[model samples]
Target: MAQNHEIANEVLEAVGGRDNIASFAHCATRLRIMVNDKEKIDQNRVENIDKVKGAFFNSGQYQIIFGTGTVNQIYEEMEKMGLDGSSKEEVKSQAKQQGSGFQRAIRTFGDVFVPIIPVLVATGLFMGMRGLLTQPEILALFGMTKETISPNFLLYTQVLTDTAFAFLPALVAWSAFRVFGGSPVLGIILGLMLVNPALPNAYSVADGSAQALRFFDFIPVVGYQGSVIPAFVVGLLGAKLERFLRKRIPEALDLILTPFLTLLIMITLGLFAIGPIFHSLEEVVLNATTAVLNLPYGIAGIVIGGLHQIVVVTGVHHIFNLLEIQLLERTGANPFNAIITCAMAAQAAACLAVGLKTKDKKLKALALPSSFSAFLGITEPAIFGVNLRYMKPFVMGLIGGAAGGFLASLFHLAGTGMAITVLPGTLLYLNSQLPMYILCNGVAIAVGFVLTWVFGFSDKMLNEMKISGK
Candidate 1:
């Protein structure tokens, strides 16, 4: 408790005291601080503070890695010391002000998608569970086969596994509306219109089972069951239109007119204009992603797996959410999940190696738990706190990531989902893919451990840290 206060005081002193702090907030693992002047803070002094893992300037804020529970403790101490911290969202808003337009755009995409990840993850787990239950071998062990399974049980499984993607556009639209400062309920209605049963089913039209409704035999229209980009576009345009209408419409009539007009106009454009154009664009993006992922001999894997963490450092990795969701929508699986899992596992293993090899008790305490967090698919602590803190371990982790990714590609290992990886990722591979998924992560962890053990850590690094008080 006293250490938390001391750390807080040290941080305040390092950053040129309370008056220099413009605003501050803490996420799960870091203290994100905005300063009145970047030059006023001593970056080296802040990083060298005891229990502070690392520090970096990113996304318009000076972020100090404090690792999980300790960050909250330190944040509380800071709060007690007359530092009036902003809410994380408020801090994020200020940080967004500092970012370039492209960074802010990417961050918006992140905000829109993050709220929907848990639902998709649950649906993926359900899919994996269904696959396991229906497998002939697993069914045989239970004295049953696909033929012997009850129709009701099969229907139940479908309900669990198929619902999310079936109405994914609705989810996307709802989230986008919320993020874009519009009514989410209207977003839901608008999204439902896109997938309304009155339209020819999208999959059926694609498979030649049904023909799309056409006007003048030219503009064909179909339901957007699993589409992403169209729903997002509609949500954005709809929110903007709604806001525009709200300002112009009389207050007495606003309640009735705004939603009515907004929905009527957006739904028309959504079906006849935005839906067709963006859905085509979405297909192009999906095809391009597939082509890259299918690049001969794991080339895609090696490149993406090696450099993905580097992208994370820049805070733009959330853009992958779009590509990943598209892949799942089209293919019913996400190969990208396996490759990224290797990267995360390598990070964990490298951090673990550093922990095991280091004699410094403080370093060991930070590294080991950070490594465990990475194993569960959250890698920030392992990356910024431990691995990147020692440059060699990060490099070793990247190499290990590439190696494991190569195997993932060679074995054609993929997951039933995204957003979950490494140990929890095992749930996504619960069917026939379990062994290969395990193997990929095993190779990543092993290579990371071995390489870091042999070359990434040494007594000299510790000596340097001690000498520099870093």
Candidate 2:
């Protein structure tokens, strides 16, 4: 660790001291740096530094890829040197050069989603466990009677489980604000407005009679209680708007007026414009998804299962959360939920395969825990630490994910609620689509396990490819 730290500091100095850095951030495995002049930085020198795995520039940011644990320490050192930005110029420039249409769309989605993954996984697992404990049958199986599951315990568990989803906008707001160099508090306040219980609700009339006027009109400012997209959009707008206001507002009144006016305008626009547009788009996507799933279960499962890892990696997996919640509210079961479950099973299979096949003792140890975690619906450890490091495991995971997805779709298995654990969550699909869900899940896990065993451990496999040539 000391050697790693010294290497990181040397690399930072090589790139150009604190003043040369425009902004700095890190993902799971890379230290992302924005420099005032990329040409002035010595990329080769930085890359050659000890413990520096690799370095590259993309999306207008200089990125130094390092071990996951090392990246954060490096970023902290950068912050201490005052490299963090106070302006939006770097982000704006990156956004503009990101290209147009689908390319830009995917990048934007990834930018918004990746930062909040840790929180999502933690909360998701808590919810999944809560579901297991709450089930009377499951409790009895554990030798704990219904009396053991107290109301207070259930209530607290529900709160812990649902906190992430319920305050999703706030999370989005905080993340976006950080990215944009704005006050997260302001963004959180704006996000809360869209979901606030004190705010007015929308109503409908069935018989062509006049509907009573609710507090706010039904102009598509739907509740953003558990939303992801709206807060992100609003945060982007707020950041740019706040910066603009700071320069324009007079120095005397800038402190109070800047935030006040910024919040008002951002919230208004979020509700009236951005919120409605995305809401409609979401509805369309949901409807299209339902239609696709309703057609043929096997095909749907295959596509969803295969794309599950990709979706999660890109961070758009939350779109499924919205679809699931919407379906549950309307129909009590969600078709998309099964896709995620299968995705987890596939990841686990891939991890297990890599664990069994690896010659390196350390790699195998890493893979073993990752496999167990992925089976429990936590894929980050497997994705970043194990599968991602081995080419074969990643491909196998994708193939396995697709296989599982297809099976789930074919069986038409749907989940009653979101889950963090795949094994226990399968029970949630038992009531309406029990047979199909079981069959699909079983087939997916079996295929994943078999394929991983067959391909992952083979001597000729890509996982055997080693950087060190050991």
Give RMSD to native, each candidate.
Answer: 1.8, 6.8
Quick one: how many clashes does candidate 1 have?
Answer: 0
Candidate 2 at 216: error in angstroms?
A: 12
Model 2 residue runs over 4 Å out of place are 1-107, 110-130, 133-175, 196-198, 202-232, 270-277, 293-295, 310-337, 358-396, 410-442, 455-457, 461-470
Report the lDDT tens digits of candidate 2 across residue range 83-157. Answer: 664333455455446445655555555555556766655554564456556567777788887687678887897
Which candidate has the highest lDDT of all?
1
Per-prediction TM-score, please? 0.95, 0.64
lDDT score at residue 345, model 2, on the 0-100 scale:
80
TM-score of 2: 0.64
lDDT of 1 by residue, 114-165 (tens): 8899999998899899988889999999899799999999999989988888
